[model samples]
Target: MAQQALPVRTARLGRALGPEPTSVSGVVLLLPGGEESSVRRPSPMMATASVRALGRRLARTGRADGLVAHVVHYRYRGWNGGEAHLAQDASWAADEAVRRYGDVTVCLLGYDMGARAALRSAGHEAVNSVVALAPWLPEQDVATPAEPVRQLAGRRVLIVHGTNDERNDPELSFRLAARAKKANRDVCRFEVHSDGHALYQHRHEVHALTEDFVLGALCGRGFSRPVEDALQAPPPLGLRMPLATGFGRSLRR
Candidate 1:
């Protein structure tokens, strides 16, 4: 069946909106990557094909009816290492979302460096879940003042990475997820085989996976059987360690 088109418009304070703001089932904040053009305009990373598709799908699909979606535009183009200025921007956007939605559920969706911002700011009380695509976690990086992974102790987090990524090491994302899981946070890590950091080869698949999580988290509508199977499938390569554990062996009776 064909889906109806959702209204879209630019809002004040660097936000893009979909659907009417009077009432909404949930609010989704989309954070774009740090890669910017010479003029600091909204780069392709800001509106990745997958991210844009997910926003439109949520707006039109029955599972996410009345969802309010926003893609944030950052003030600058380059990533400010350890400063987390983008995290501050995202946190402020979250506050504005809450003010507009009035006690509604909220989800943070991000790609690349934007994923870092979302992960760092998940400590906000209103965020119900976070979806990060191709997150760039540099090696040997001490946690910034933002303390990104440490903040997801009680939030739902989904990190999806591609095995063929050349720009960012997929292992870094796995390590981040492991840390989050060890903290007893609800977390899931999925690896897409034969794809790069941008995931251009399988764009639709990327969008579909993200859409399933966002809808489920916000509306309690679980993913279809096919999607569920894909998510549960074993990794294409590398070790798949358990994200949870029983009591320490020494403490066993």
Candidate 2:
């Protein structure tokens, strides 16, 4: 009897914004969050909406720099434990960017579970930097090993978490950032005080910081003073730097 063939899952890229792929100097891949253990195809969700909004903003802001942005549509709706479906999808997106754009730099901007995927996928050769917003990190326990930071070496990483986050532990992200900083001095983490996992309380500040880090990494622009200080400061201080209000307004001025 002939065995039935299994279906193959594939990740895809959403419509892109900004300059065409061949003309762009850099690309930003937006990875959206999903559940911890669901294989179901994703429907529109708040997490996806968040990253989509961010992608549009990045496309608009980066247009003049010849930067392009795309939202990554994953094969499944979960991290799926060790399978890490989303991370694999992110790496595929990076590879796709390289295939389409030659050797241009790539940045991964992700939220929640997507943030974890971005961090994991940064090891891709085409990826130059990452911006993780309210990342959902694994709990410290024997059952689940700590996420690896060694892969972050030679890449710039920015992790932003809300101090009052209830869904994901900010401490975990700080720990990851501290470890990553040892491997790459460009790693930094920022805390949005009194905000929750969604980081709605400081959305503008978060967006501003992300823009600063991504542009600084891919377009050779200077990072804002706070980000620069956080990246250069010693552990603890750097890992827990507080994000200030009006940060975006100040940057524009």
The CA-based lDDT of model 2 is what?
0.88
Query: How much is 135 displaced in model 1, in angstroms?
Result: 0.5
- Model 2 Cα lDDT, one tens digit per residue, 1-253: 9986425778988889554544788999999998899887777555479788778888888777878999898888999998899999999999999887788899999999999999999999888899999999988798988899888999999999999999999999998998788778988899999999989988988888888888889888888889889999989898899999888885741
TM-score of every candidate relative to the true structure: 0.76, 0.94
Task: Candidate 2: give its CA RMSD in angstroms.
Answer: 2.3
| lDDT of the candidates, in the order given | 0.67, 0.88
Clashing pairs in 2: none
The clash count of every prediction, one per candidate, is 0, 0
Tens digit per residue, CA lDDT, model 1, 26-106: 888888777522224345453444466667666665333657787776655545664466677788788888887788788
Task: Write down the TM-score for model 2.
Answer: 0.94
Residue 125 displacement (Å), model 2: 0.6
Q: Give lDDT for model 1.
A: 0.67
